[model samples]
Target: MYPKILICDDVVYSRTMLKNILDQIGQYIIVEVENGKELISELLKSRETGAEFSYLFLDLELRREDGISLLREVRKMEPLLKIFLSGGISLTDENIKKGIDLGVKGFVSKPYKSKHVKTIFKSV
Candidate 1:
């Protein structure tokens, strides 16, 4: 089966851009959400269906909620979930450290690159 990927970003452009890149890499079951609430909902649904997502591309700066806080909650719900963080200017050193501490797999900044995304896709 194709790997499942969940992308949560408040910005429409960011989510679309990342989805496009992943589409180019290979076959994947990709789901997009605009906020943490939707993301959590998706996760719960996956758990109920017995088809957990293989990866998560989460944004560090969400308009309605804090990404790190959301990440903390996600970790509790799905401790083994492979999470990669994304952000533009708000991707600071401290936040990166916090995410690392919270057990994120890695990070990809804004303006998602196809090559970088491919590498991440392969690693997972």
Candidate 2:
């Protein structure tokens, strides 16, 4: 199935940033959220509507809550969804361990490269 991507970041610019990259993918339907709260809410709503979430680009830090908290909840509710974490969380062993436990697909940075986004979309 063609994946529907969700971008969740507290920073307005960061959300716009990935939205631009995901738009270039042509096939995947991209959705945007401002924080973990909105992300979880949308996930729940989408679940009710039978719209599957395929990819999620989540920022680790948020004013209201952390994406890891949302990640944990997503695993419980939507285990099949693939997640990508960016900004405020390093790709460290501990973080990778946590993300892998929930089946994260990949990651991008705050200042993501266009070429890398192109490559990743092609590969996925």
Q: For residues 1-124, what per-residue lDDT tens digits would candidate 1 score against the true structure?
A: 8989999998898899999998888899999999999999999999999989999999988998999999999999999999999998878999989999998888887888888877866776
State the TM-score for model 2: 0.85
State every prediction's TM-score relative to the real structure: 0.94, 0.85
Show the colliding residue pairs in model 2. none
**TM-score of candidate 1 to 2 decimals:** 0.94
Residue 95, model 1: lDDT of 91
Runs in model 1 deviating more than 4 A are none
Q: In candidate 1, which residue pairs clash?
A: none
Which candidate number has the best lDDT? 1
Model number with the top TM-score: 1
Global CA lDDT computed for model 1: 0.91
User: Against the unseen true structure, what C-alpha lDDT does each candidate score?
Assistant: 0.91, 0.76
